[model samples]
Target: MKTALPKLEPGYHQRYIIPMMRIGKNGNKLKVFKIRTMYPFSEYLQEYVVGMNGYNTKGKPNNDFRLTPLGRFIRKYWIDELPQVYNLLRGELALVGVRPLSEARFKELPIDIRERRIHYKPGCIPPYVALLMPDSKGNIEAERIYLSEKEKYPHWTDIKYFFKAIFNVLSGKILSS
Candidate 1:
């Protein structure tokens, strides 16, 4: 992987890439920046990030032989997730908060969690990921673990997340590292 950041040329079609979700009851657009994971599905104008292993998801294998060589490299060190920091800089996301879901997945979300997940600006990274950093199972578990703490999460604020994020990073843990 290159040491340099690959900056998207200005006017990159973000809405086409990251996804803009509408909660339906109200008009809103929450920003997210993600690398192209799956080929775009015309029906949803989105792509899916295949989980590394079956663990706890329904997507086809991430290590499927079909992945382009670039895909494999991107997935290896999580370089694919780096673009989201731009989303953070733009204020569509916070440094810490629940991970954003795509409109397709968002629509499938139970109303309450969807409502809560969208309440705070979604984040470039989330907290419970500390313990959940192994693989998709850990990602799933992190979210489950977070569900109990979700309500208080908002009041928990940015500063708290920053410290915890530091702890997790220093310890070399991540929900999907």
Candidate 2:
């Protein structure tokens, strides 16, 4: 048996400052910072891959080949997301809420859900951490529940979900996908 080599050279530095964007509150478009975790040009293939592979409940595609080995580890521990702290500092994101979606993903959602999601800023810790859903549909449902509760409880809803998401991360009950 022969082992395969990586298609591209290892890119530790390239991973540090990749620029991406996400849908923000009121449908504002925001540039989000992240460590690059996928193969070069992976973003261009997102739709094709998602169509074929389908997203897990967490909204990650199953058996994604775009991820490099280091990327996988980075994603598992969410090291890839560290740069998004800048987005938080910029007030484009909350400590707890739904994960931000790309324009393509956002457009794929139902109109009503899209309207509801855009009502609040996206979050660093998503509702999925609290609900632990089994599929993308379940993740959507979790977000719906969080959004509804947020409408009723506002600060308390975020505070409660924030703590729950933290506990889940610390205990390794949920991980970035």
Candidate 3:
């Protein structure tokens, strides 16, 4: 007998919605909101896809077939991330903090980094937005700097980073990937 595929909810294919849950501070699980940028079931293929396609400078799978043409446009202009404002309002995210990771991705991080990340809420704008890292290591380092500075100056650090990220985005120095 053939197994039946699960039915996607009405408007799921047409509307913006996060494909999966993300790991949040204190080990909480939350649904991160994003415009659906990939083909159906792409979430299940993340590791395989990345391994096959290799990572881009921004650390995303390069030349990924999963992305639709519209998705690419949305990502280029950072429109795909607009739904994350809902996550922010819901208290699952902040205006500035480390980007939330998927469970699989979070587990791949070093123990110390994971520990540091779990200490604060995830953010809509990642630290790399301000620094424009060229690789995953640079991304990690940027997050490390942000998290460390946050510990020393919680409010001021976020405020500073928030403005910097806005500046970078507006200047076209950073685009969501």
**Candidate that would win on TM-score:** 3
User: Candidate 2 at residue 130, lDDT?
Assistant: 83
Off by over 4 Å in 1: 1-27, 37-66, 133-150, 153-160, 175-177
Worst 10 residues of 3 by lDDT: 11-20
Predicted candidate 1 versus true structure: per-residue lDDT over 1-177, tens digit per residue: 645534545655434345434332122566455565444332232233333333233122444544446655675566677877777777667676666665655665456666556556666666555444445444445655555565665455555656777776667664232
Task: Provide TM-scores for the models.
Answer: 0.58, 0.88, 0.89
Colliding pairs, model 1: 133-174, 133-175
Q: Which stretches of candidate 2 lie over 4 Å from their true place?
A: 1-15
Q: Write the per-residue lDDT of candidate 2 for residues 1-177, one digit (tens) a residue.
A: 965633544673356578676889999988888888888778777888899988875668877899989889998888988988998998888989888989988888878789899989999888988877637787778888999999999999999998888898899888778
Compare the candidates by lDDT and give the number of the best one.
Answer: 3
lDDT of 3 by residue, 1-177 (tens): 875656777776666676558999998998898888888777777888777887788878777899988889988888888888888898889999898889878887788889989989999888988778747777788889998999999999999998998899898887677
Q: Hey, what RMSD does candidate 3 come out at?
A: 2.8
- Go through the candidates in order and give the clash count of each: 2, 2, 0
Which residue pairs overlap in candidate 2's backbone? 57-135, 57-136
